[model samples]
Target: MNNRLLTAVFIAAALYLSGGFTHIAGAEDGVTFIPKESEIVSAATGKSISVKSTCPSGKRLIGGGGECTGYLNTLGSAALTINAPRPDEGAWLVECTNLNRNPGEIRAMAWAVCADAGVLEKNR
Candidate 1:
């Protein structure tokens, strides 16, 4: 009986050391996030202008945001707007407007994170 128990222990140790039946799980479809660079936005008459960044093929936008940069955002009346990425889409939209009723150009950047649909589903 002692010999049989020792043999069982040795077998279990070997299996563990050999990585048998481990079956480690990971992301489903290789989902990844990416950040987009800044883009240019020009608006007149306090009207809002939109800029967008799209992900590559076979990838979808997970989240995104934007901010307005320039003298107008600080000195002049300027505003920035960010919208969430739609389902299964790689489009991130941002709108910037000059709130001072003056014609000016402001620099804005839109950023987004993308991932594969299958991977996203696995996460959920």
Candidate 2:
């Protein structure tokens, strides 16, 4: 009886957690996915990408065909994650690997969402 109850508990927990799993519908994300501009970039591979303060502020490229191409090829898919930094402000963390070619320059004003948010509005 105890074993059966334990199994039921485990199943309940799994279902509860899995129920919250989210799927981004209709979002197109190629390798090295950056959903918005001005997001911090990954300095290294196989690790959590971060926000780099060094990114230029005046609407310029962030990561240009940099070393990211090395890791992008290793990944089959990537996610463009957004973290809220402040109220009405957020930053992106992206991981990219060039499957066929080198990564081009990066900028905070690169995505339509960034323009709508007014973070990269001036560049638009």
Candidate 3:
């Protein structure tokens, strides 16, 4: 097991030194992975607001996360998620709802991680 680990590390080091993994997604080769983010805030209290954010051309969504913010110590929360349909498209959807039935506004944010479309092609 130890020998296998050592071998893997040595191979990675060699590849790095040889410039096999030096180019970024935006480089001339366009083989790097870049992260994309999107966010949406709710306007009305006690109501659910959904928002979607899209990625740029030539990019694909790989991962995502989200969060919600509302009144302090109040019955309010948010839900966020990622919507990825294809390698060329992705969206961040956020829903904020108030449970206290009060006049308050909540905010929801979603983050989407995107990568160069070329990266996907290379792997396949």
Top-lDDT structure, candidate number:
1
Tens-digit per-residue lDDT, 22-69, candidate 1: 532223335444445444555676677666777778876655556666
Q: 16-96, model 2: which lDDT tens digit per residue?
A: 423322521111211121333333343333333423222223222212111122233245222223322221233323333
Candidate 3, pairs of clashing residues: 25-32
lDDT for position 14 in model 1: 34
Winner of 1 and 2 under TM-score: 1
Angstrom error at residue 75, model 1: 2.1
Model 3 TM-score is: 0.49
TM-score ranking, high to low? 1, 3, 2
Q: Looking at model 3, report the run of 10 residues with the lowest lDDT sum.
A: 76-85
lDDT of 3: 0.45
Taken over the whole model, the C-alpha lDDT of each candidate is 0.57, 0.28, 0.45
User: TM-scores of all models?
Assistant: 0.59, 0.20, 0.49
The candidate scoring highest on TM-score is: 1
